[model samples]
Target: MTSIAPPRLPEPAPAGAAPPTSAPVLRMRGVTRVHGGGATQVVALRGLDLVVYPGELVAVMGPSGSGKSTLLTLAGGLDVATSGEVFVDGTALGRLSTKALAALRRRSLGYVFQDLNLVPALTAAENVALPRELDGVATRKAYREAVAALTEVGVAELADRFPDQMSGGQQQRVAIARALVGPRRLVLADEPTGALDSATSGEVMRVLRARCDAGAAGLLVTHEARHAGWADRVVFLRDGMVVDSTGEPSTPESLLDGDGGSTAGGAER
Candidate 1:
């Protein structure tokens, strides 16, 4: 891997934000997300507890409506928890004003959505540089950072290509570079491989694994067991709660051989 400069610190973290040396990048305690009201109420998550430390990649797996997406939304500060607290870098999310929360996200977080939302009108490099520009980085510096990030993901040559000119896998890589550019230390990916073939999915997973190995914390929500294999740990969710967890990193072969086969609230070795 080519050496890239460390992320430049953004303006001082908002008041109440934890210092960068804090251990866990993300922490959720007794979080719950509810939808609607009255008889139409629906509980998307129920008292979920999750913690992701630096240099770790945790994969979340579950069937549809298992609250996997909901978890990402809450963790990224996109949605508020109905109850309980969510702390990113040790600062309580609910305590921040909208402006402070936005600043935190801009400086410390990266999110890759299932749809791989790249700006259609922008070239790959421009797309990747958008976040840094939004954070007030100089155009030249942000473009340089974009190229470095694209190179890190093996897509530097695609920097000038538009989304329409790239393959789905290529576009996905660009989205990742966009998320990874600058000094962000935490990434949350929700079904990032949904549009790719098994082979391309593996490629994307490899990039995510590499990022985590390089010291960024990652939270990946994936439906494919094989895709989950790249994570350091697997968390299985059922009805908005964690049902089982894997203690060791699983391989594609082991994940395909059997269901992790743990009863509720147990760890699968």
Candidate 2:
């Protein structure tokens, strides 16, 4: 009988490679976020510190309400921190004015949500081009970039289809293309594969991983060990705080075969 060997995991950093000299693409220092006030105050993140460098993908894993989504929102500039700082590409998010922050988000960041929020009325290409157009790029230029992005994510043929005309996986791919349309330095994904089947989910992970390898920084929020295996590192959060983080194992195949590591709050393993 012949035995197949398990696939080898990629090194966290290439063997004997020089350390990175550039600043992290995304950085969070002593970040915290609170909701409501007085009796209703709820802490979403508590003094979390994280950094994701170019060519790296970090997975944030925790139970529901463990602040995984909160971390992504703050990192993406969708929500402000109550205290502490978030920096993207060396610019402090807190220091940027509202307009400047909006501009920065449009030009430098990409966000993917579990809901796959493509506009129902717009075709896939138009939806992907909207951000570029809103950022003041010419319509032709934006649409050209949109087509290129869709092609990168393997969805170019569906560029003219409306949201309702595609399958869930296809819509999700379009959403990913929209996130990746511009010269984004950071990609923040919140359960990007939560709604897809196993095969489709794997495909999405491959796209995200490829983007990171191509010099973008990625922060992925996922509960599945298989998905987390795609990341270079896994951060575990509980009670709004990071309790553990570790490099991906040498044998990623083991992670999915029940040898996956644990996360904070006992939710992931």
Which candidate leads in TM-score?
A: 2
Model 1 pairs whose backbones collide: none
Residue 147, model 1: Cα distance from true site in angstroms: 0.6
Tens digits of per-residue lDDT, candidate 1, 38-126, equal 99998999888777767778889999998999999999999999998999988999999999999899888998887788999999999
Q: How well is each residue in 66-96 modelled by candidate 2, as lDDT tens digits?
A: 8999999999888999999999998999999
Question: Who wins the lDDT comparison?
Answer: 2
TM-scores of the candidates in the order shown: 0.83, 0.85
Q: Give the TM-score of candidate 2.
A: 0.85
Instruction: Tell me the lDDT of candidate 2.
Output: 0.83
